[model samples]
Target: MFNFGIFLLLLGAVLVYATVPIIKIFNITTTKGILVVKLSGLALAVIGAIIMFFAQFPQRLEFLRLI
Candidate 1:
C-alpha cells in the first residue's frame, strides 16, 4: 500500500509536470479540459500523500476511524 502510494504520487507529479505536453498531445484547449487534468493530478497527489500519511501513522488512522 505504501509503495502504491509512492507510485501514485510520482505519477501525479509527472502528470502535473507534463501538463502542457499532455495538453498538446491530446489537443485539449478548453479551459475546463485543462482544469480537469490539473485537478486530477492534484487529487492523485493528495490521495497518495494521505495514504502515505496513514501508513506511517496507523494510530492516527485508528484515531480518526477512517479505515
Candidate 2:
C-alpha cells in the first residue's frame, strides 16, 4: 500500500507536469484533451494522498491518543 501510494503520487506528478505529451502518447489527439488528462492527474494525486494518509493513520492515531 505504501509503495503503491508513493508510486501513484509520482505518476500523478508526472502526468500533471507533462499533461499534453502524455495525452498524445496515449493517442488522445485533441488540443482540448489536455484539460481532461490534467483533471485526471489531479484526481490521481488526491487519491494517492488519501492512500498515503490512510497508510499512516494508525501511527498518527496512536500518537494523537498519547495526548
Candidate 3:
C-alpha cells in the first residue's frame, strides 16, 4: 500500500509537472484549454493524496499482515 501510494504520488506529481510545458507548447491560453489542464492536474493531485492517505490507515496494515 505504501509503495502504491508512493508510486501514485510520484505519478501525479510528474503529470502535473509535465502538463505545464504541454499547455505552454500548445499555447493553451483559451479559457477552455486552461480549465481543462487545471482540472486534470487537480484531479491527479487529489487521487495521489487519497492514495497516500489510505496507505497510512491501520486497516491497510491489517490487510497487509493477512497477506
Candidate 4:
C-alpha cells in the first residue's frame, strides 16, 4: 500500500509537470481537457496522501490520541 501510494504521488507530480506533452500525446487541445488532466493529477495526489496517512495510522494513533 505504501509503495502504491508513493507511486501514485510520483505519477501525479509527473502529470502536473509534464502536462503539455500529455496533452499533445492525447490530442487534448481544449482548455477543459487541460483542466481535466490537472484536476485528475491533483486528485491522485490527494488520494495518495490519504492512503499513506491510513497506512501509517496505527503507528501514529497513540501519539494522535495524546493530542
Residue 36, candidate 2: alpha-carbon lDDT: 80
Which is the better candidate, 2 or 4, if ranked by TM-score?
Answer: 4
Which pairs clash inside model 1? none
The digit string of per-residue lDDT tens for model 4 on 1-67 reads 7667777888888888899999999999999999999998988988887776656445544566433
TM-score-superior candidate, 1 or 3: 1
Q: Write the per-residue lDDT of candidate 3 for residues 1-67, one digit (tens) a residue.
A: 6567667677666666787687888888787886777677777777777776766545545665432
Instruction: Tally clashes: model 3.
Output: 0
Worst 10 residues of 2 by lDDT: 58-67
- What TM-score, to 2 decimals, does candidate 2 have? 0.67
Estimate, for each residue in 1-67, the C-alpha lDDT of model 2 and write its tens digit: 7557777888888889997678767988776787788877888888888786667545444665333
Local distance difference test scores for all models = 0.82, 0.75, 0.70, 0.81
Measured on C-alpha atoms, candidate 4 has an lDDT of 0.81
Residue-pair clashes per prediction, in order, are: 0, 0, 0, 0
Question: Which candidate leads in lDDT?
Answer: 1
lDDT of 3 at 4: 73
Model 4 TM-score on a 0 to 1 scale: 0.78
